[model samples]
Target: MANDNKDFFERVYQVAELIPQGRVTSYGAIATYLGSSRSARMVGWALNKCSSWHRFIPAHRVVNRKGLLTGKHHFPGGETMKELLENEGVQVEDNQIVNFNEVFWDPSNELL
Candidate 1:
């Protein structure tokens, strides 16, 4: 069970790292790519603990299905997630990514 979780988290990191600059993906998207669409929330949980990871994971590039920055509060400083997205040239309004479909990056379609 521990090994399975470790592998799952590693897979999540790999997919999250694949996200291109100025693009974002959803927890559900990453979970789906990993063949665990039901584990979307788990994906977010794994990312929350990603600070301990040796490599830098662009966790800010992940959002909810509605393009909402649901995990923003999990960041150290307020607006950190928003700042990261804006830095990548992604427009954000009310904590929601504008033109979400345009910026959305799905690992399933992209990694193939």
Candidate 2:
């Protein structure tokens, strides 16, 4: 009766919650933590539709595998997702993550 699978979206948010203010994670990283690499796109879909949960999820902190800000359209200003990230200390250049290896947050290891 719990509709366990229905919580995939919630699980996605839980993972997002683990991303620190000045760091970021990939959609694939979050999907893998949820036990399915194939779910990365689904994770993106959930974030795109998460209009009410934006404040809680920090959906702005998630980017593509290559660290590209591919979800910019979903942001409230429609183009400042990168600016928001920059404000959080994430260095974005040419629409790609700079020093990705350093700023990446692996929730599996970093978060309890």
Candidate 3:
């Protein structure tokens, strides 16, 4: 189980790195792309632990299915997630992405 968790977490970081600066994907989408459709929460858990990584993972680009910044609290400073996305040109209001579909990037489709 330990090795499985580490492997899955590494995959999550790899996918998170692929998300475009101004786009976002859901935790579920990453899970499904990794062929672990039932592990959306696990994906989130992996991203939450990404601070230990040697390189930037851009975990801020991953959001909830509804485009809600549900993991905003994990980004260290308050509003850091929102700030990162906004800096990428993704608008946010009330902690929710405004034009979600336009900015949504699905790994299953966007990636091979």
Candidate 4:
């Protein structure tokens, strides 16, 4: 069970790393890419525990399925994850993505 959890976290980070600098992906997307449609919560748990790796994982580029900045609390600035994303060229409004589909990065090909 421990090893399985570790593997899940590894894959979560792998998916997070694929999120482009100025773009974002949803937890469900990463879960689907990992072959589990119901693992979105697990993905969030993995990211929460691995906040130290934000430099490589781009954890700030992940939002909820509704495009809400649900994970903003994990950002270093505490309450400016959206601002950081904007600085990276991503447009955000009301703590939500303005054009999510336009900036979504598909990791299916890269993950395989």
| TM-score comparison, 1 vs 2, better candidate | 1
- What tens-digit string does per-residue lDDT give for candidate 1 at 5-89? 8889999999999999999999999999999999999999889988889899999999999999999988999999999999999
Candidate 2 lDDT over residue span 1-112, tens digit each:
1456448888888888778998989999999888888988989987886777646678889999888999988887855888889999989888888978888887767765
At residue 109, give the lDDT of candidate 3. 97
Better of 1 and 4 by TM-score: 1
Question: How many residue pairs of model 4 clash at the backbone?
Answer: 0
The collision pairs in model 1 are none
Task: Write down the RMSD of all candidates, one decimal each.
Answer: 1.0, 2.5, 1.0, 2.2
Q: After superposition, how far is residue 8 of candidate 4 from its true place, in Å?
A: 0.5
Model 4 residue 101 CA deviation in Å: 1.5
TM-score of each: 0.97, 0.87, 0.97, 0.86
User: How well is each residue in 2-109 modelled by candidate 3, as lDDT tens digits?
Assistant: 998999999999999999889999999999999999999999999999988888899999999999999999988889999999999999999999999999999999
Per residue, candidate 4 scores C-alpha lDDT tens digits across 1-112 of: 3999889998889778877789888888899898988999998888887765545667888889888899887767756788878999988888889998888776765556
Q: Which of candidates 3 and 4 is the stronger one according to TM-score? A: 3
Off by over 4 Å in 4: 53-55, 109-112
Residue 34 CA error for candidate 4 (Å)?
0.4
Between candidates 2 and 4, name the one with more favorable TM-score: 2
Q: Best to worst by lDDT, what's the order?
A: 1, 3, 2, 4
